[model samples]
Target: MKKTINAPKAPAAVGPYVHAVEANGLIFTSGQIGLIPETGELQNGIEAQTHQVFKNLQAVLEAAGSDLDHAVKTSVFIDDINDFAKVNEIYAEYFTGDTPARSCVEVAKLPKGALVEIEVIAVKKEA
Candidate 1:
């Protein structure tokens, strides 16, 4: 069975799902938006939102005993596909090495009208 994972530094989930779940040696994170944990507010724009998304993902991964370096795959959802280049810039900042496989798409809407949302799958590094 899978075990749910939560990050105290990340925004609390507004839905039923936990921030992530670990099964075996892999962790699957639920889509994370730009909501700030302390303020519970969405970031101002795409750039800020993208950065917040990564930070949130990082926190969850850390809680799951993993990090971006171990990420095997990721999915990015944005309200405007045109923002891909801008978001990609921010994303590249996090996954600096051999980047994980990723899929990005434009969505009509997101929770709390977030500009972006991201989800990741990563391997738990040997402790």
Candidate 2:
């Protein structure tokens, strides 16, 4: 009925939350930041950080037996609205073909002063 998704390839949750949770045919993921899973190091800048965020998201999705291509919705949080364009560029690299519906907004700050964070929802398709 329900399942928890965990991935050693993604950063551990900062709080008491699963990286992703699946119920029925859908998976809901927690917000992912730019922290590298191996070292827990935050990435350098907007470009690098955004890339890392997507990587983290991908890992969680994979753990849930889903992927970005299966995403139906996503929410992106940015520390600076100015970085919107750059983040979009990096984000598009992953979600370009049949991009999931998304909502991106600027926030005053994020946990650990990270530049960007993303949360996603995906559906597992039957073969």
Candidate 3:
């Protein structure tokens, strides 16, 4: 069975997509920008924006009953590659383990002109 995850603590999707979907023990989360859920405002700077994106991802994963520690993979899209190191620094704070497979790329743009966006795939732990 497939399950959809939603959380009020994360920014609402600007497009027609669920925050996350879980099926057969795997959870796939949609890309998260730096929009603050309650204010619908984007965070400031690459450092702050990256932190917000991670926070958003964390919230969605929690809603799906998973977590960053369970993430098997992550994909990050940044508007500028120049900010890669800064983003990576913030990302490392959340993924402090052997670390998950990851891909980072520079894109021409992102929704709401966000500086960065992130998505993850995680496995549900056995009870």
Evaluated against the true structure, the overall lDDT of model 1 is 0.94
Stretches of model 3 off by over 4 angstroms after superposition:
none
Question: What does candidate 1's lDDT look like per residue over 1-127, in tens digits?
Answer: 8899988989999899999999999999999999999999899999999999999998999999999999999999999999999999999899987999999999999999998999999999999
lDDT string, candidate 2, 62-114, tens digits: 88888899999999999999999999988889987888999999998899889
Clashing pairs in 3: none
The local distance difference test score of each candidate is 0.94, 0.92, 0.92
Candidates 2 and 3 compared: the better one by lDDT is 3
Candidate 2 — what's its lDDT? 0.92
**TM-scores for candidates 1 onward, in order:** 0.98, 0.96, 0.96
| Candidate whose TM-score is highest | 1
